[model samples]
Target: MSSLQDIPVHVAAEWGNALPVLHEIRHALERLAETGEARVIDLNAMPFGPGDEDRLLGLLGQGEIEARLDALGVTQIRETAVPGVWLVDHRNADGERLVLHVEIAEVPAILRTQAEDLRDAVAALDARLATGASPFPHRPDN
Candidate 1:
């Protein structure tokens, strides 16, 4: 038997052709700066190898916010270390990743409140106020 010291270890840094995807992300950022239009890049469409996704995610780092929504399926949205960049992951009920995308914008559109929803909320608040129900009752001071 050979000693452990005799074994040779080969280490290689592999990005798996992820440079092109990085370039695309840079271009998207430029477009957002120039036109104020958000860009979405679908990672599922790219030919990413085993370690490529890890590399890309490592570069982006982590952010402060994370949100999850369950409708027809479960959707997870997270912001990257970059201020205006967000990662959106959608998984089916079976827990399979269905969509993986990077959105370049101030905020992802899916997380934004719709005008109709806001209107409904406002109406509800108005109705509640009209009832004149005091959330806190007046207490006599001793």
Candidate 2:
């Protein structure tokens, strides 16, 4: 049998950035667990070697929840296989990426309704009820 030193492992000339990203995620997760503080990492701001991003994403894998929002542009939010980890993509109308964020939280902030919107919704609901319109958009399936 050949000596262990004879093994051929192809190493890249430059270090892979994927592990660093994972490290960041791991630390952020720890902070979140300890302090309930969420962290967001901007992937665009990081330097990525060839295949680094793909490797990182592959490692993250996919989870159950996905959300798509379209306003001025499109925003895609997906949960990673790791609980409390999320991937968020903000894209322009032209399908260009504006920001790519890895968010560590129970749920990504983008999914939460803002206080201003919630207050407005309260007023809107009262007005609709005052107008005697059916409050329920769809009747119960009784």
| Candidate 1 wrong stretches, greater than 4 Å | 1-15, 124-142
Each prediction's number of clashing residue pairs = 0, 0
- Tens-place lDDT per residue, model 2, 1-142, is 3786598756566457899899999999999999999999999998987678878999999999999989669999999999989999999999899999999999899899988899899898687677755758875333
- Residue range 1-142, candidate 1, lDDT tens digits: 3787588745366746577888888888888999998999999998886678878988888999999989668999999998788999999998789999999998899898988889899887787666656644863232
RMSD in angstroms, all models?
7.5, 8.9
Q: List the residue pairs that clash in candidate 1.
A: none
How much is the lDDT of residue 124 in candidate 2?
Answer: 82
Q: Relative to the unseen true structure, what is the C-alpha lDDT of residue 133 in candidate 1, on a scale of 0 to 100?
A: 63
TM-scores for every candidate against the unseen true structure: 0.73, 0.81
Q: Alpha-carbon error at 21 in model 2, in Å?
A: 1.2
lDDT of 1 at 139: 37
